[model samples]
Target chain A: MKMEALVHLVSAIYVVSVLLGTHGPVYGRLVSVNDKPDPKNAAATARWLVSQNSWGVLNTISSELGGAPFGNVVSFSDGEPGKGSGIPYFYLTTLDPTARNALKDHRASLTISEYPIGTCGKVDPENPTCAKITLTGKLKVANGGPKEEIFAKNALFSKHPEMKDWPKDHNFEFFKLDIEDIFLIDWFGGPKPLTVDQYLQAKL
Target chain B: MKMEALVHLVSAIYVVSVLLGTHGPVYGRLVSVNDKPDPKNAAATARWLVSQNSWGVLNTISSELGGAPFGNVVSFSDGEPGKGSGIPYFYLTTLDPTARNALKDHRASLTISEYPIGTCGKVDPENPTCAKITLTGKLKVANGGPKEEIFAKNALFSKHPEMKDWPKDHNFEFFKLDIEDIFLIDWFGGPKPLTVDQYLQAKL
Candidate 1:
């Protein structure tokens, strides 16, 4: 009887931990399963995304706690399709006091798109096409703490060696966009989109 | 005769000063002119490019020198279409040592593209469009300069009032991508491209 009681206590602890963990209410939005993305199209899109460099808009926004605002750029991955570990993701980093405060206070939305004239590869000038996506989610600083922070930091450093020597104490925080909804305008056709849940459930 | 010689000497000094003070190479690569851009397609492309909000990719270069070698979603504008100033432009306010150093050592290249998946809005998901434009230009610290710097500071501040109180001594530099060339697919079909010179010359 004591062993069973202990087992029940342990199960309760596990449930409570999950409820209060990083992936709890902060990630409350539900994502529907995505249809199997077309392989050829997905590969092409992934290639184009990964082949380029540079992203971000320099802007200032009001802080959540109220005060002076700050300026920063939100970034993301173009996800290399067919590349198992290359799923696309978005992030927010700022030195702006207001933006940082707001990020900590509420969910943020990120809109992504291509430069009008193109910046990395050959954009078909005559049939020039562009894409835009909006991701709504919350931001959570991912530096320090357990293995997750270490892994994220290493991954960011490996991809951006130039930032290897950035000052350590500066409030340089990295936050991941736990994407909830993804709305896209595939100029080739419809305006349908895939949710994060659908995306995760789809067999890529 | 003395007066003439003095005039000539003064003229020589003026020319020398102008030449030395210019920030770019004395002789830029001559670009060939091309036919007018197809109006219908150009407008379509322009609209598409303008509608994008975010993107992701790796910027594998120095940020201080100007190689913002990281992936971040940047806000950009399509400058007035015909005039060079009206072309698409990206604004970056970075204090990264590497990017700053790179900007000082070499002109920067900005590569950007749409993310893959149905989410980030790829034009032809199957042929994800992208572009690479080399901003081979100079960097200017936007402070305590002559009329141009003052005007620029005011203009930028007005556009971004939130940054009015940022430290004035920060290495606040404006890096302009005097776009030398653009490689784009899906713009003019898939084969041909529009060079910066061509676009400028064909400007309506």
Candidate 2:
């Protein structure tokens, strides 16, 4: 092989690495299943989505746009990878509208997809078989005791080490979704009917 | 290089290539920039975000949540990759809450992040250095005539070819965000000041 051709091949290999190797599994929460969950196993599937994803879209009532529903890309953690508590937690600041909106109206939702986990194979992201989840309920600031705070901090910091060093002036605080409803679509039958209790009690 | 080591290295390269080799260029919209857009070029940066990203969280007022803001994972197109019109378009159906929500209320926002673009490198997704854009405005069904439908259909089908074969029973139709305000954070100074006119008029 010519030296120039070899260099081009090496560069192509490196770019591919950058694209595919970027899903940071700071913890072992990401599960690579050979197949998606059965449509009937709604709770287990919902739990899997929440635990595996490091970030999701947090929704809130936009106080600025005459009460428009606002969504923002935010990093979150449910637990320490496989040991998730089935509750999504976030580190947020009021500088962003999401946190501010949540404070005024706790009604919110968190949406996540299985595509980024790399287990969906060749299917398009919108495919029903690929799986998508939305946890809808109240978004509340964590007023839990020191133990709860520690849990939230450790879960978030494990997946996102950079969070610990975010600007102190931003007044970043821990928040959790007080989920009242769960909408999980893992197969062809539309959203699997799931309850909050089943989700929290499921053993993944 | 020893033959044994070379074989392993070659295999690793092949796997990485398979992982990153998926996003085909419908156009040159997928700019793998060596560096991010300068914060000063607000319109250019915002347009770049819309064109480069194939998916984002589409937000709308949730009629079920009693007028709360809702966000859903969605795939979208601005144009054929690089040929984007600075206007985000989506193929949606009433089977999904996003399209249903929009039908009830047009106020919405589309949020995209630079983390997925692979340009942020080692920077965390939540880090300020990583760019995130929120295009706030009305999410309207495109009834601009058959010309608009053809444009949207072509643009979307080019990126997500599977959409062309999505279930006809789902009744998917074209929807576009009539952008009113832009909030983009590419640097530490906070959301850059950008206008709708500036975003659509910027020369990419």
Error of 1 at B104 (Å): 44
lDDT score for residue A26 of model 2: 44
TM-score of each: 0.36, 0.87
Instruction: At residue B57, give the lDDT of candidate 1.
Output: 21
The DockQ score of candidate 2 comes to 0.42
| Per-residue lDDT over A1-204 for candidate 1, one digit per residue giving the tens place of the 0 to 100 score | 354554454445434443444121211112211322333353333223332322332122233312111222333333322232223232333443324544544343344444321331232211113444334444446544676555555544444433445455545555555544443433444333455665444433
Q: Report lDDT (CA) for all predictions.
A: 0.34, 0.79
Candidate 1 lands at a TM-score of 0.36
Cα lDDT of model 2 by residue, A88-122, tens digit: 99999998988999999999988887776657766
